[model samples]
Target: MLAEQTIAPDHPVFAGHFPAHPVVPGALLLDWACHSLGAGQSAASREARFPRSCGPGSRLVLRAEPGKEPPSSARRFAITTEDAGTEVAVVTGTLGPLSTAAGT
Candidate 1:
């Protein structure tokens, strides 16, 4: 899966993170990756690494790639992002058991 997002300059988090030079928080980026990958139904266990700082108004492209394996209750996904050709962040982890109910 691929997703795109932009951190607006007026976003509230920037004010407290830094009044002078604002950057998007890593936690928020991780949350975005989870949502983009539709992992809400599963208990996702992941770690994120930020190699570059992303400031306000930066356009980010997120990509989620599945591991080379068949589907199962636990699944691995590699999530990464880039902004204007520069790599920004990467997250890798496994999703917990899949839900059988609808709309999970």
Candidate 2:
């Protein structure tokens, strides 16, 4: 399951973040990514790099990369789980200029 939301200029987070154009907070992005990854659903260790901020209605593609040896190479899966049903992820992360799904 993947999750994504665009931060509209009138969103609450933007209200406090800035009165003018709003920028998505890094923490929020991280949380969104984490949740999308379902790290808690499976109770697996997870990691995410929110390198970019998404604006209102921005499209985010969150993919779950499950396997061993980790995603190596420049373009690879940053997140990985040791077991399919262990509920314990071995590694997880993100890579890219804006942390897009195509980053790695």
Best model per lDDT: 1
Task: Provide TM-scores for the models.
Answer: 0.65, 0.46
lDDT of 1 by residue, 1-104 (tens): 47887778899999998879997777777667667777753544433355577777877777655644434444455444566676645445554434421214
Point out the worst 10-residue segment of candidate 1 by lDDT: 95-104
Candidate 2's TM-score: 0.46
lDDT score, candidate 1, position 20: 94
Which lDDT values do the candidates have, in the order given?
Answer: 0.62, 0.43
User: 21-96 in candidate 2: lDDT tens per residue?
Assistant: 5656656655555556544322222335533444544444444544443343112233222233432322236432
The TM-score that candidate 1 achieves is 0.65
**Total backbone collisions for each predicted model:** 0, 8
Q: Over 4 Å off in model 2, which ranges?
A: 41-51, 70-104
Q: Which stretches of candidate 1 lie over 4 Å from their true place?
A: 69-104
